[model samples]
Target: MRRNDHSINRAACYRSKIACLVFFAILWVAFYHAPAFAHKVTIFAWVDGDTIHTQSKFSGGKRVKGGPVAVLDSEGNELLEGKTDENGMFSFKIPQRTELKVVLKASMGHLAEWKIPAEEITGSGSESNTPETVEKASDKTSTGTGSESIKTDVEVLKPTIAGPGRKEIEEIIDASLDKKLAPIYDMLANTFDRGPGLTEIMGGIGYIIGLVGVALYFSNRRRKE
Candidate 1:
């Protein structure tokens, strides 16, 4: 009877150990394979005659404030002067349907620009377009003066026309605001694409399971001793 009771107890201990291992394995898998939610990029830009007011935000939804927002004409003439607000919001106007350049000058001297297509600015609302190419232009003046300027040139390869009439320009502007924001959409989508993968998830789960197995093995050995 004593030997039988001892065997029963040993069997019960093994079952308990298996149950604990299974519980931890389930938890590890759940954490490892959890779905990552998609993030949105928010950009706001206002236009008035060859000028644009613009702002940008990252995935965490924090705006870049106090940045210099410059609007330039196709000829590189400075048209409107503006600065980003406390929340990174900006407002300015540009010439009607004219190809314009929007630039952001960060405090650390980092510069980014997007060329506004002529079709994007003709009408009533704001539109966004990705600058096809980005280059770092010299912000320093050639003249012996120490004055600095953010002078990057972005070219609009394809000019989109807003047709002939005023009404047509208005219609085009209204229709393209959503399309203008395409660059920002693409940026966020690409970020998610480059994030963690299924293999990484599986590896994380496997590591956690291995740790739990090690702990259980020692626990069982001690019990037997």
Candidate 2:
């Protein structure tokens, strides 16, 4: 009779673990994918040369294309504004040499921002400021008697390069990065689609059964005392 009771207890523990594991796994996936329990929308942006590229999406991987995008200066002045494309992508050139703020407003009252530093845009070949080399030239000029010549040299040092246009460069970088990141995105998408696998469910059930076994062992010891 004692041996039968032990076997029954072990079976009961395994059954309880499996039931709990399956219940929680289904509940978690349902809450994660269901619109009623979905999370807020999000946005991310990066600068490729003079153009800023952005992507916006809801928590469940739905694109937030056609969303309003606003570009602002450091002092909150509007610089430029536009809407995202069908793929939730927005690209815009830096208007002036100042700190920038890009804000995206999606549907359902979702909003996000990307704060870009002034150094990121400025000091580039396309932007302004080459004062380091200019200062060195001015120091040499100070040794002579041509202070005005130093000012002229400063202007010459601020050389601008004329290469591919902003939009073209943005497209090139985006294409390159997309190629590299495609595999990672595919892996994540597959993971979400597959949900919890058989091995994972079995592992979770095993852990729970081990915990219950330990508890039963302690309880049995206490009963004997």
Candidate 3:
């Protein structure tokens, strides 16, 4: 009778240990496979013109909040507008052909305006020219007055030109904004996707440890029984 009771208790302990192990294993697996889904955005502003402040905000391929506020335009049109939080901040959702003016009101009646050229405000314009290199021939001929031909290398650099149309202008702004916000987006996406994977692995480890604890507990309990 005593041996039978001891064996029964040992069996029960083993069953409990197995149950705990399975529970932890399932939890760990669930954690490891969890989806990552969180995002946040940051906004920044640059004063492009004396009266124009270009503010852009972004998060997860969307706009954030704030604006491309124009405090004054060439026509004296005062435009003040706030951006959508869902869209991230500065948005180019306006009509392609319509010209946009932004106005901003600062503290104590301070005001500023920015006039984004139509082409520059749109994305359909040609790329602006950057400086170009001009190599002059180094061969020099005497200018006849004992002065050798002053053959020097001359580099002619071109000034950058603005985009040609509203659509192009908008495209340029978007491209510039993207360049600024790319790093932030990369970090957020990585954290959102990788965070869950790490959490799951940790949970799995915890579960395995729990399984060991359960086995030890059962063993001790069976001895007492």
lDDT per prediction? 0.58, 0.69, 0.44
Model 3 stretches with alpha carbons more than 4 Å out: 1-53, 56-80, 83-89, 96-99, 125-225
- lDDT by residue (tens digit), candidate 1, 21-110: 999999998878432222433344544434454665444545656667777889988887677777666766454457878776654335
lDDT of 2 by residue, 35-61 (tens): 221245555665555576667666666
What stretches of model 2 exceed 4 Å from their correct place?
A: 1-38, 123-125, 133-225
* Model 2 vs truth, CA RMSD: 13.8
TM-score, per-candidate, Cα-based: 0.36, 0.44, 0.23
Q: What value of lDDT does candidate 1 attain over all alpha carbons?
A: 0.58
Worst 10 residues of 3 by lDDT: 132-141
**lDDT of candidate 1 at residue 214, scale 0 to 100:** 100
lDDT string for model 3 (84-110, tens) is 333323433333222555554332333
Candidate 1: segments with Cα more than 4 A from true spot: 1-53, 58-61, 123-225
lDDT comparison, 1 vs 3, better candidate = 1
Rank order (by TM-score, best first): 2, 1, 3
* lDDT leader: 2
